[model samples]
Target: MRSRLFDAAGVACVLALLYLERHLAPVPILVIGTAMALCLLLRRAYPVPVAAAVYGLAVVQVAVRPAVRMVDVCVLIAMYSVVKYHRRLLWGIVAGGGAAAGVLIAALVEWRSDTGSFWTVFSVVGAVTATVWASAYSVRTRRLYIASLEEERDQLARLMAADERAAIARELHDVIAHSLSVMIVQADGAAYVVQTSPAEARQALDTIAATGRAALTDMRRVLAVLRGPSAVVEERRRPRLADLAESGLALRIEGSAGELGAAEELTVFRIVQESMTNTLRHAGAGASLLVRLERSDGTLAITATDDGPGSVAGAEGHGLIGMRERVAMHGGTFAAGPVDGGGWQVRATIPVSG
Candidate 1:
């Protein structure tokens, strides 16, 4: 619709000018000016083709008529359209060159008649054509640059969303996997001793209930993160290493983690929890495991050794991989393999700041 309005205005202006100067080759003026005006309708849709057609008629007009024509202004409009709409550099250079050449031809013809100064005509026409082309090229460059920035912003948003999902998965795995392992162990022991030992069975049942409540609380905290900041939810504190004692796992630690950052403490807690969970699920009955954490030289080192008949081959489960990723996020090193003598050992080292 905008193109139609521009075309109508261009046609009206061209016809009006030809009417005032109808005395100088009225037939050629009417024909060429009308063609140029009509071509403006397709300028945006077919910029290069319209530019080529307009310049072709301009060359013919310059030859037949010696003086500058008002219809000649359409050549600058066509040059602008070519560079503004098309992304190709070759088309813009071709259009600008064609306009310049036409301007020089008209100026030369006027100079020969001694009626107009050639330099004056060439300078004014060349400046206007060059200005139009340069302005269009500038607009095109800025538009493309903004588009690329928007694309980059969208890609970064997608990457952030993916990382958020992976974090959620890791949290769920740590919470559910650890709690279920404890409950399963307790339930199995209860089943084995329920007939002969009622007091021991009752203790196992109580432990199961406590483990379920802790798991439920941890699950709620994890879910709250997905509900957005507007949701009224209390943030859970980082898990302490001492909390694992209630889980009945034979674990040991040798250093004070009081100075560790909240993130580092949580990472440490999840690593040990996942290791204990793996030990419970993979190791057979009567298997024993020990976990040790030591701080020295501005670093915290973690080790978990289990005297279970577990092999190192293909031991990289989702839980262990998650533990490795957690440690790596803090610029830490992690390794898991079979011990030289027996069982499996998982070790990690994380840097700390005082």
Candidate 2:
């Protein structure tokens, strides 16, 4: 409220200057001076309003006292303020042109009665026009600078997000691949003990326990991604399909799983592990699982199909969705659905660079 009061007080001072000058017969010097001051002060908050008022006052001064030299400065100062603060061409155009036209017409009318010289008229008009053009140029330059900064800021933000996602993806793959492989190995060993080795099945349970502990450690790192990355999680190394086949996932390698980057390798291994786990869970007593890896062109394709208890909710579950995201991180294509004859099929084609 106090700030507004001061602004009003300042406006009143401008009016007071005009009134005093009118009585003293000192021309429009005080009037134009005060107009310039108001334009400078109010440009940011009230660009259009201030520009309108300044140009209007110039017109009024030209009408009342045709020989006034003070109006030029007010128009010039106001035009600059509008350009710098408002950063708009329209306001600058209106204010600048208004000042030049009003002064030129006034000088033409007051030619014989006042100084009656081309130099005086041209000088005043030239000053107003030049000031307005300079203001417009300044506004254009400032707007360009602002746009450039915003573009750069957006680019930096995207790069940071990509780096963080890469880190998080690595952590997820490590945890999931390690845990599921250990579980399959344990489940397979337990199967052999159902007859005379019941005590050995108890040992398999301990392996599951160890795998679960490792999973929990990785889960902490995965959850940290959601909280925002303050520190980089260390990369994890896990057994590949070839290394893990002994765990009884029945890993059948048709081609190379590739010595690609860690992130890509992790994605392929997780897809295989996830598909296999789903098979073991839903494929009844005698479900046959087939894991195939083939290299086609510059891509490695992994296809896991199971003659399970028919499809195993392939498309409607989180397993499928997670697999797709893992594949997509490397700009790959992932597809999973029911095969033609009552089975589940999950396929992923990830890029490789030799």
Candidate 3:
């Protein structure tokens, strides 16, 4: 509603100027105003072309019969509208606007029959040129600032998306890593007991059932996070290297646990777990996983390998991407590939600031 009122005012000013130019009282002015108003209707959609047409018409008028009356009030307004809305070639628009104003003002003053002095002409040119340039400069600065703000907002949105993906990856690790480890341990225990002790094998079966249910519950909780707030998402605990090595995973360490910060230790632990989990998933049930953590000088080297069917290729998923991101976060070198003869091997050389 307010925009319509502004356009109506512009139309009224244009009609008043046209009336004075023709000395046609009000009738001819109303006709020209209505015609120009049609251009205004589509100005937003085609600002540059509409403004160009208006300026072109004025240039023709100045060439034929230059007068104070034909100085073009509507043309200046249209040019300003083009710069404000069109948002292209700002430097060119400013230069064009300044040039047009200067030319029109000089022509009007020079051609006026009852003109005064050259100083009067210069004064008008200087004043009008200064005012138009100032207005154009202000518009250009505001547009540049708005563009910078929008770019900053886009960057912030990307950071938020990355954080959400990281949290989800952590949740998936907690669910799959512990489940695979416990299952492998139980299966090995049952196999050893099957020939020697049948009762012990039955006990291993019970452990397998319990581990499976726990894994299912972990998955359920993870999926629940996606639903509405009516559902609860429990806090999931992730399996680190220390937990597996201490537990029945039979992880072997080559060197002592060097003096390390909790954060660095956690990073090492996660790297080892992710490696072992990958082995269990792809390397088959009887895969032999060997873990080695060695610290020397100022670096920690953590490596894990499994002698199993992982000698062949399966698929690479989000797990590899997440592992790379985690290792890169703390400035570490990571390598994971197929061994020459058999199995899968992963190694990380991480810097430790003791």
Candidate 4:
């Protein structure tokens, strides 16, 4: 809209200048001048074509009258618009050079009749044309630079949003998958022994209720973080090596515990939790799982091995992928596969600064 208004004002000024000099120029020159002035309306939309037409009309006007007229100044406006709107600098330079050459040649043609030196007229016209072209090129370069910066900012925002979503997914998966696996196992056991053994059945039911409550609390904490950084979040204890006892996995420690950050602790907890859950789902009854943690030489090595004849080929799911992603976040190495003899093992090594 602003370009349209600006072009309209330019055409109005050129028409007024042509009217003031109407008596000096013949009817043919006046008609050509009016046509050239009106062409500025489409200059931005069709810069190259409009520029070519305007320069072509200027040559016709010169052939009609050898001396420069007031209406001839409109060609400079066309020059500025062409360079500002066009992306190719080579084209702008070529068009600007052509127009400048035309001005110099026209001034030379009238040198004998008019009382001015051809060099003086050429110098002034060339300087004005160079200044207008330089200004237009500068504006175009700055506009492109700003556009590139905006594109880079948008790409960074998308990457950050994707990372946030992945983090949320990992947290939810670890919480829900582990809790549900435990509840399902306990519920099945309670159903099997409800009539024969009342005490064991009641104990299983109690464990399910406790596990459900803990899962709800963990989910609430995750949701609170999602709500916003400013939202009130209750502090809860992070998981540790000792927590594996609740999952019925035997634990062994080879070295003293090293100081770890909160994120590292949660990563360790989730890794073991997922491994134990996989074993429980895939291994049949009477299977045994042993988890070992060895910390030494600025590194912590974790290995979970289960002695079960069941093949883990059918147990590959998002739980295993989530564990791998969690370990990667800490710059750790993880692997899970069937053992050489007849078992499955999940192992990971995490770096520490102890």
Most TM-score-accurate candidate: 1
C-alpha-based local distance difference test score of model 4: 0.80
> What does candidate 3's lDDT look like per residue over 136-254, in tens digits?
65886798899999999999999986886676668577557657777777788899989999997887777777767766775676666666455643534433455554333445656
Structural similarity to truth (TM-score) of each candidate: 0.74, 0.64, 0.58, 0.70
RMSD of 1: 4.9
lDDT of 2 by residue, 8-79 (tens): 665566556556556544445565556655664675578678867777776666666665553345566566
lDDT of 4 at 333: 97
Candidates sorted on lDDT, descending: 1, 4, 2, 3
Q: Residue 116 of candidate 1: its Cα lDDT?
A: 82
Off by over 4 Å in 2: 1-35, 56-71, 83-97, 109-201, 227-230, 235-255, 285-290, 314-316, 321-343
Flag the better candidate by TM-score, 3 or 4. Answer: 4
Model 2, residue pairs in steric clash: none
**Number of clashes recorded per candidate:** 0, 0, 0, 0
Among all windows of ten consecutive residues in candidate 1, which has the lowest summed lDDT? Answer: 230-239
Cα lDDT of all candidates, in order?
A: 0.82, 0.67, 0.65, 0.80
User: What is the descending TM-score order?
Assistant: 1, 4, 2, 3
C-alpha lDDT (0 to 100) for residue 256 of candidate 2:
71
